[model samples]
Target: MAAEPQTTDHRKRPRRRGDALIAAILHATVQELEERGYAALTMEGVAERARASKASLYRRWPTRAELVMDAVYSVIPDPGELPDTGELRGDLISVLTRTARLLDGPAGQALRGLMAEVLPSPERMGQVRAHAQGMGRQMMEEVTRRAVHRGEISPEALAPRRMEVGQALLRNHFLFHHEPISDEMVEEIVDEVLLPLFNTSPVNSAT
Candidate 1:
């Protein structure tokens, strides 16, 4: 006998495939950056690497800076994954350690070189600067929010600071390429330089 038709389970929305496309493009861009470095990294290169045409890439990204920014976004760890641990020291250390790891790799070298080359163009520099600010600020905001939620610091204290600690750490390497920045130094900077500044700040005073 023929079996009766079972009731269909419906209501599930079709999954968005755009993320996959973006992820693919991002991955391809990263590979190109690493293999070719900044000087050779191009839209045509990324398109060829990604198996898509130059037109497709242009539709999504009008400029090399924007494409590079998207690729950067794809690689950096999502803020949600960062642990709170309820202690500023631990949180800062964790993030720094991670940042160091990313910088120590090939992609880091490619990006650092790229940063130097793009300085000649005011327009390109502006685009790169804005992208960096958006990503860096967002990450710092996450850490600051965690600090307040855990009673680590006053909400006002952290917000006003604009999360310069991360910037300072990266600047150490960017500004002085030869100076050896150690993980030990990362801890020392966090403990010695930043911690004291926040502790005595008026914004952090008990509300």
Candidate 2:
């Protein structure tokens, strides 16, 4: 007698949760971006690669741009509290170097793609700048705050432009020159620009 035909059970992929799920999605995003470039990236493709549903991605990140930005930012080290090197210049250099290194990898590629796509849309450009510059500013603030506490700089030294100078110079070099930021360039920014801005004594005015 012939045996009854066996049935194949089609099962849905197991649900991924919490950090594991996010990690898988992020990894898939980077892989997709690297392989297909930003223009070819899609929510459907990422979900397929991640073995997750499109609903899962949309729930976390409402748009493709948001998802890509989050993936890029994930690789960047949190500024946290940096070690106090006991000097302003050393602290600035250390923090700036870290930022430069982050921009040299996947974050850099994502940024280039984001800029090209978003430049034509003012709203999108604003979103991109806020996401990118916000992190840099936070790092700079941490470095500068420590300097103030150490008496290396005064409260008056905390000006908006002064706080922004280090990251701005580093970003300018990266965006325009499109080269890996060098130790020499980092030093130049700290020495030639930031140090003077932070350390300079205010000019006295005669009434």
Candidate 3:
């Protein structure tokens, strides 16, 4: 009898087909941004670089801000699902610090550059800010749920400012600076700043 052939999980394989055109255009946009910066990243240039049509690019991404944001996301990577490292602090540190590095590194510059252009267009700016806000909110919500699961604090203890602590880490470090936020820095910020500010202090029965 022939030995059974081993099989790899096709689910993990990279799948690119229908989305390839969008991916190619975004990839080209990143190159244009890196070489010519935002000022030169026109629809025509992106079309030329992507070997796609200007009409197609405009139909997909109507505005430069939209084009750049889509492109920037493709260039910079995001962290994977947050694993329970058995402690709330450790878990938040992992999620947030990775987030910080993403912002401080590749994505941040592009985001900042996008904002500079987007701000002039109020409608575009709102959409861009909303887009950014949605991502942070999702991550913070997960962090909060994990904190509750770890029995780190009373559910009510974290209720008031659950997002405040986690997102603030990203807001303060990434939005404000060029420094790559380190794990040690995240630990200190979470333990020193966040815990002290938001972690439950002893409930006094004397009240």
| lDDT by candidate, in order shown | 0.70, 0.83, 0.69
* lDDT by residue for model 2 (1-207), tens: 999986532126566799999999999998898888788899999988888888889999998888999898886667776766888889889989888887787677778888888899999899999888888888888888888898888777776656677887887788889999999989998888888788764442111
| Winner by lDDT | 2
Give candidate 1 regions above 4 Å deviation.
1-17, 178-181, 202-207
Best by TM-score: 2
What is the TM-score of each predicted model, taking all chains together? 0.77, 0.83, 0.71
Among all windows of 10 consecutive residues in model 3, the one with the lowest summed lDDT is: 198-207
Candidate 2 error regions (>4 Å)? 1-11, 18-20, 34-36, 201-207
> Tens digit of lDDT per residue, candidate 3, span 75-156?
4334346676777677677667766776764466677777777778888889877776666666656666776777766565
Clashing pairs in 3: none
RMSD of 3: 9.5
Kindly provide the TM-score of model 1 when superposed on the true structure, using C-alpha atoms. Answer: 0.77
- State the lDDT of candidate 1 residue by residue for 1-207, as single tens digits: 999986533224332247766777889998887787767888988876666667767888987867887786678888778887678878877776766666665446555665786889998878766765665666667776787788877765665444766655675675468444578877887788656655555544443
lDDT of residue 51 for candidate 1 = 61
